[model samples]
Target chain A: MLAGLARQGVELPSACQAGACHTCLLRAESGDPGEDGRRGLKPTLAASGYFLACQARPVTDLRAAVAGPDVITPARVERRWWLGPRVLAVRVRPRQPVEFRPGQHVTLHRGNGIIRVYSIANRPGQARRDGLEFHVRVYPGGQMSEWLAGAAPGTGVGLGVPAGHCFYLPGQPAAPLLLAGTGTGIAPLLAIAADARAAGHRGPVTLLHGAAEPARLYLGEHTPPGLAGAGIRWRACVQSRGEDIAEAAADELAAQPDPAAARAYLCGGRGSVTRTKRALFLGGMSLASINADEFAPAAAS
Target chain B: MVMTSDPRPLYDRLGGKPAVDAATEIFYRKVLADPVLSPYFDGVDMERQVAKQAAFLTMALGGPNHYTGKDLRAAHAHLPGIGDEHVDMVIGHLAQTLRELGVAEPDIKAAGAVATSVRDEVLGR
Candidate 1:
């Protein structure tokens, strides 16, 4: 069965060839299936034939596909950069043509043979250069971080195409947009705001960027030049000065009329993202209208 | 008020680091083929990315908190261009990962809820 799928060029999700990550999950359309040690599968899914393809070898001829229609494809790295001590930017191109709404992320295959995920920081069409762009921060001693720090330009890498669900939805033209981001987390938010402006969006757009210190913010030069005159309000909040940028932004958002009508996007440290969401939700924005992404260090290995 | 039985200790239920490590690897392989989600990893270093994710899972699942690194927003601020579809794509990946790990339906739902809770911070919608 595996040979047939490979012959058909049907690639399944996998990571840690040692039976980890569980990216390739499928349900048996019809067949007797066996299971192995990969975690995350529920008895219900198992009873219904759900199994991780990486861990399960077909006992008999098996017919299967991902339980959901969402299939992940590998992306090729087109660019790389060292933004700061720990931040890196990698641009990836999809093996196939694709489109995304903005504020999404893709999983990356590092030189050390590990797969990590990062957010898309370039506008949808703007990535026309060769591949999509991603912003990553390296954690000291992190498998990918150490490799990226020493990697020279044109280094080959692996990636998964746009994978996150956080993005902007159209049809709320009159509603105010409050976009807040910290460090690399700002990548997706910036893409959303930029796309809105480039597409001639007319709603009031405000961007509040925060970092530990002013120097930590990386994309000052790459900020969309179009937003300066496109009615998109931009602000930088440096939290090291003891000013709660997220709180201030939330307060400003609260002052707006019909807070429920406003849409808020918050990205950054887990603490700030959590605080911003709580503050804004309590300030009256509808929970459905709020979108966020939180990036933090991996738990100890 | 009496607290409900908290299932916060899901790491043990999911088979700890070995299980999580395996699931993380499979999840990345799937992400690579996903047209909608693969673009974000264009120039990424896959090895380090994998380790960071594993470390993150370790901490997220209430295991040992070894992920002493920068927060998410700071790490991703450079790209500055993401959207709704991207956010949704990530959530979908997380959901798929959970499904692959053999996590129970209730556990998967709980994990989804955690992912949903952070959607705003991720997409900046």
Candidate 2:
């Protein structure tokens, strides 16, 4: 029966068939046990009727549902560029339109079968065409970076859309907005700002961008020139300079009125994002109003 | 001298910093020409990112620990939400890059496994 399923081209999630990885563990709604102990469900998970389809043969008819979305489509590599020696602006677009909150990311498939994830840099409505965009910084010898450097136009890449929980929730439009980004992570904040502007939001939008040096900043050209005129004020901080970008952003936030009623979004290198979020929270901004996304380096393969 | 079956050091397998740097440069060029991802990188600085990536890789691949940089998660915390699909695409590009560099098949697979391990962390899952 497993052969039949495979012959019919039924794909299932699986890793480490010995059940060590648990990638194929699935909940069985209703089914009777088959004789083969090879049926990969652990005793504890099996008591709850969780079984591995890879190990379980379909006998006496079975019913099951996947925990997550069944179909995994590759994201398209829409563009790429070097923001600095280590920062890569890898813009990705999915084949389908994915709906997500302001701060979130998707997983991308390098041609070599490695998976690297990046945050969505554009908002739902800001794509101007189709699919969302993601900005990625390539760490040397990193899987995604290597593939991107050598890929040509019209390459097929895999992508899992709209993952991650951090995002801006809609609330009273009058709340002040505090936005921050470091390196390629700035992509999402820019998207949110653009979305807010397109929606004609009148709230004050302050964007604080930081980098190790002025040369490392990405997406400066794509930043809408009218952002300031649209009531969105942006300030850039070079952290290698005497004053760090987070410090400048905090100072700018302090000068604003009623900061307690503001919503803060911070993105960038892990340290910068953490520092900025802590500063905002200590400055009286409610914890619930602050959203953060961390851009971790892809571990060595 | 006979080549040993034991794995070569990552630096040797990657052909040193210069080879990695070349690969990085090629990756950005591909990204810029792509129809879907191009708009995001328009007007971005490519030279600086290439240099930083070389340094980061040198450390990651066990050559030298010269990467004095910010943590990854904090840097991307402010981005628009990324989904599973986007992650797959990024991974695909990475795999292609290894192939371009003439990396051994086993090494490529090992590299891919490493990238896959961190999917949840990078995607904020």
Candidate 3:
């Protein structure tokens, strides 16, 4: 809600400030209740006239509420394994069931205040059978990846609520679903296919996970049990060094016969997402039918 | 003046929606009268064009960031031979509209500064 305000110069100090922090919390003593201002706030606090300024979009005049810390849950590492040379697959079990949709990202915080965000890779079926799976690549000198490298099974961790909108939607079961991405972007695509299959989508779901070389393709030989008999088809493409990932994916998407009948999702680097969206649009897909999530480079901490 | 809005944004201080409506109306009138800028809107729907300009101004003045129009470069890419003279004529019309609306001197200068910042992009340089 404050997104529009921020665009108009009414600056609100926010980080992941995702209503998890007191940064945007405000009171609505009187006036139009903000649209979902009470979302992350406690019921008692939300009921007695509290709301988050970041979440609250007041259609009418309103009083601001004071802020508080977001509720966080504890998670314990169940197990982990390396998918290939570069990608590490780590599964963590929260103490209790965590409500989240496939394709949403969660914020993980270490004990000493080191915070990192990662996408949850487990589909609903995988979540039930295993736990939350995360696909993390070890970037040189990356603190979060370093910590995960040494983290032991049963180690304690904290997770913020799941957030982001690049997930599969039910009720569109028959629409052709196109999921394409590079590198760790395969995590959300895996989860999306799992959820779509679980939701009984009979339509063709095509997933193209790309990398610079054949060895970097992590899920190449291993197909998920959930998608084995389901109607989901997965493919991996290896681009020569410096070959654009989106260009490679767009070539595949443009070959499809009916672009208008497909809902295409493209993820990964900003350049790839933007180029693929443009390519898809040029290939006859409506802009509204395209959904994209860009993993922009994080700023130097 | 009867103030019916909740709080004043920068757009409101510049006389709100009605002022934007009027400014676009007058600014285009000035533009269409000039030979340098007239051809750009020759066959365009004036009503639609006015709405787009108002939305652009609203965004530039710290109002709702709801402008859905193309970025300035993309919007002007089709025009041929657009140069400093065409830009001056367009900016002159906007400055005239702001002056006519009695939008304070500083605000008008600020608005002009904002417009000038996009000169290269608008010129597609």
Candidate 4:
């Protein structure tokens, strides 16, 4: 596809032609792009005909153009609360309802071209006018985090289209779900667990949240009543107290007596996400069954 | 042997993208289960790899060659520690996966030949 386009005098910006770098993203204005071309793009982008030029072998004639600037939805801060010393829970109300799943992320656009991606921490349409929820990790002097920490209700912000493939997927109600995260990464896992239960997931759902210490674990004291009722078990793993969260979570998963297939969702810092994924995969989880969302360092932010 | 000059691309004969997708699901499972190969893929997201593999396999089996020869060499050169043994093992897995999917012996051999044709570039030799 890339070659054909170049031959016809069309040049697409690209790097890592293997599709690792999404630099060659193009929008199909007319025809269907292969799923492989849209593989890791946000569901919303895929649905709207965005695809990777490097990966797509177009079966149908596609009228494609370079992806334009992201569409930004205006939003307002509705509420803010501290999840822990370092984690701030934020709720924002978009001007209109933003279609997003439980665990996908959106880029919060501050003025001056500054934007940061955050996972949506609540399921859409669950609470009236709740809008979107985000668990922002407050880094001292961090531009976006500091602003969000002090932002008042009605403070305006811009939201990029909901993006990312890490989200609660319906179907397979009986499949066991194992979720693990560290720090504010638990935000998405909470919503995913709730989404699963609400969808009538019957198999055991276990969530393990890891933090440096007990005091840093915000949800340790309170498991949402709705989640508790949904039979989702939540465990807090603290590293300061000698608990290796990844290993502990992997052990619990390996102990499951049933041979039923299980899916594991992991989030958090890149290192921890990679570590947990390796542990889970090594402990008999298939590579395809493990999903992860690694919080990239604020290089772009 | 009868299909040697069948005029149809091996990709079409082995079935199209859907067939490649099915073969990849089985192939990667075998690769990841192999102790020697699994280590190379540790901590990698298999879902994305599966998609990329499907595309690559489709090209290898005589589908649209989206990757330029240079792109192909660069892709393989970036993988650390990939050697002749690893390459052979990967091809073995692909062959086995096709066999499991009931692909004909001749078609499987043709696929193997196609894969081997690019072995030097794949190994960055």
Candidate 5:
């Protein structure tokens, strides 16, 4: 449905086009979205004609518009700082309570109509309330990144519905958590690890992050206090000049004991995510137990 | 004339997308659980694999031919270690999945025949 609409020159807000991300959610004013289309949506959202446009295959003519109030939350930049060369950490607080899991991503809408998907790096219900932190890798000549690099605090922005499958899921307190990511992909993994700890997970949690050079490894020796728990292992992997960070991270993860039984969350660039996912799978992890969030590069406008 | 077969396309007989979805889901679960077949999917995105498999199965069952004639052959040509045995194992899993899902004997056989028809292509012959 989304592709067909695009062919007709109607581009909808979309990311992770596989229905895992709710960035393309739309309100169907007329047609019925079958159960499959609303599979993971909240009952209330489904009741109000909301469906994932990427998943909807309407048999009859359908009219849908970008969702308003129900999906868009007004937010403001609370703080911004440089974590490393080309890495910016920004915090935004939603004007209204926007419930979201730590590792889920939100579509950040700047006033100028530029939007980019970013994973919330902080856990929900912190002492500061609804502040969402994002670790952004500012790319040279990237519109959103360039704007964000100099955006002042308190600047208004709109957030799309927070959606992603890579967040920490409860009810598996005893399953070991293995998180691996490259570059800013560590944002969501860190959030997921903190969430697991907050949920009182008793299993061991191991976090592995990799970067091209030591200077690019921002989170270096500072493991978040939230992740301080028994049997926790946090390691920053820095490879030699031209080595692939993704493979290096995957090698470390595959070396972990009992990879098959571990609940793994992998995020980062496409190559990194794919390599790490393959490593874990080959290391005996069940594909169902592995969740990956591959960052899609925004088309330069 | 006595009709020994239902004239409907196997896709319809298999009950469309929902049925194909169910079959493919069950089929992958079974394949992944089987040590012999699971390695073939190493590093392959399971979700995409399921979707592609569903589309291929749908076309094979005569629903829609979204696939080009050389797609299956071309895809398998690059993968190592695919032999006639692997093809048979996959067909067996497909038939077993339909059977477990309560598909009638004739329908399962028809589906198996469709899968078997692509045996050489799937084997990269």
Candidate 6:
């Protein structure tokens, strides 16, 4: 549905287009989203006419649009910081407060319609009321990366509403949690850990973040507040010369304690996520219990 | 005989790759733990087997048939003691996995029917 709409010049911003991330869920004003489309959705949400566009084949002609699709909140870049040689941090304050869960993602559509999906690094509820933050890996000629690397404060950008499935829900509040990420993938993980702590979760959270070198372990510089205070254990894995992210992730998975009841969230490149999910499953973790968000490069529609 | 519009493929109605992948992993675990079926997978590379099974099930369920692995009869030819009983147990475990995942009864029966349709080839009969 999204692709067809895109072909007709109505571009929809999407990432992890496999329906793993709810990046393209839209409201079907008057149609039935087929059976598979209703899987994993709450009965209430199903009744509310929400459908994942990637999987929805409408049984009837439908009026579909992103939730409040007409509203494109404009945000201005307020700050930029380099987390590593190639990774940059961007902070933007929306014209209005954008409500989103800590681990959700937002798509930024440039004037030319180049839409890029970025994971929001700010925790919801109590992070900052004024703005959104993201960690971006600068690709030399990448349009969004180039613009983001040096976009001055006050430069305007459009922020799409946030959507994702990997956010921290207060499930089994004390459920053992496992989080793993690589490079900028740690952005969402950082927020999730904060949210867990803010929610006063008493479970053990084992966070394993990997970078190619010590310097690239961006979030390791200063432990975010409450990470240690809330008893969340964090480890940084580095491969100074060449980062074998999957290997580092497997090493992390190997050390998880009693993973049976743990709800795990893994983020990183698709290859790493796939390998890690496989390893975790073979290591006695249920595949259903492991939620993953693979940071696939947002493709041009 | 006339053909009608292609009916909704079973794979889509039951959920696509993600759903099938989840079911395969859980089902494979059960198959490996079953005393009768566990022996058949003793020295097999389970990771690859799990993926192949998922692809097979996806194709069998009327999704894009990307399974290019061994034909069922050829694949099971050399296994010791492979028979209808083993096939039944494997399919039973799969049905149970989908059940555990909260798949609706109709879809579960549809999936079981797909497995039954393949009995001859899987059992090399």
Against the true structure, whose DockQ is highest?
4
Tell me the tens digit of each residue's lDDT in model 1 across B10-97: 6666777887777666666566557766666654545567676676566555567544334555555465577666666665776677
Candidate 2 displacement at residue A48 in angstroms:
16
Best by TM-score: 5
Write down the lDDT of every candidate, Cα atoms only.
0.65, 0.60, 0.69, 0.77, 0.77, 0.73
lDDT tens readout by residue for model 4, A1-301: 8768889986655534555335466899898878779887767778878888889998987898765555567889999999778789899888867887788777786665556778888888753367798999998888889999999999999876676667767777788899998988888898888888888888888999889888988877456665777788777889988987788778878877652378888988877887787677656666667888877755432
* C-alpha lDDT (0 to 100) for residue B82 of candidate 1: 72
Better of 3 and 5 by TM-score: 5
> What CAPRI grade goes to candidate 6?
incorrect
Against the native chain B, each candidate's TM-score is 0.75, 0.69, 0.80, 0.84, 0.85, 0.82
Error of 2 at A261 (Å): 0.4
Q: Extract clashing residue pairs from model 4.
A: none
| Candidate 5 lDDT by residue in tens digits, A194-278 | 8888788877788888787889888874465656654568877676556665555456556656555688888888877887776
Number of backbone clashes in candidate 6: 0
Question: Candidate 2, A173: how far from true, in Å?
Answer: 1.3
**Candidate 2 reference-contact recovery:** 0.00
lDDT of 1 at A43: 51
lDDT of 2 at A299: 38
DockQ of each: 0.02, 0.01, 0.03, 0.18, 0.13, 0.07
Interface RMSD, model 3, angstroms? 14.4
Provide the lowest-lDDT 10-residue window in model 4 chain A: A14-23
All candidates in order of TM-score, best leading: 5, 4, 6, 3, 1, 2
Which of candidates 1 and 6 reaches a greater TM-score? 6
The CAPRI-style docking tier of model 3 reads incorrect
Better of 2 and 4 by TM-score: 4
Task: Indicate the residue-level lDDT of A73 in model 6.
Answer: 77
Model 1 residue A110 distance off true place after TM-score fit, in angstroms: 2.3
Over the stretch B1-125, how does candidate 3's per-residue lDDT look in tens digits?
Answer: 21224256557776678766656656666676676676676545344676777776776665775543247778888888988888777777787777777666666666777667778887888
Worst 10 residues of 5 chain B by lDDT: B1-10
List the candidates ranked by DockQ, beginning with the highest: 4, 5, 6, 3, 1, 2
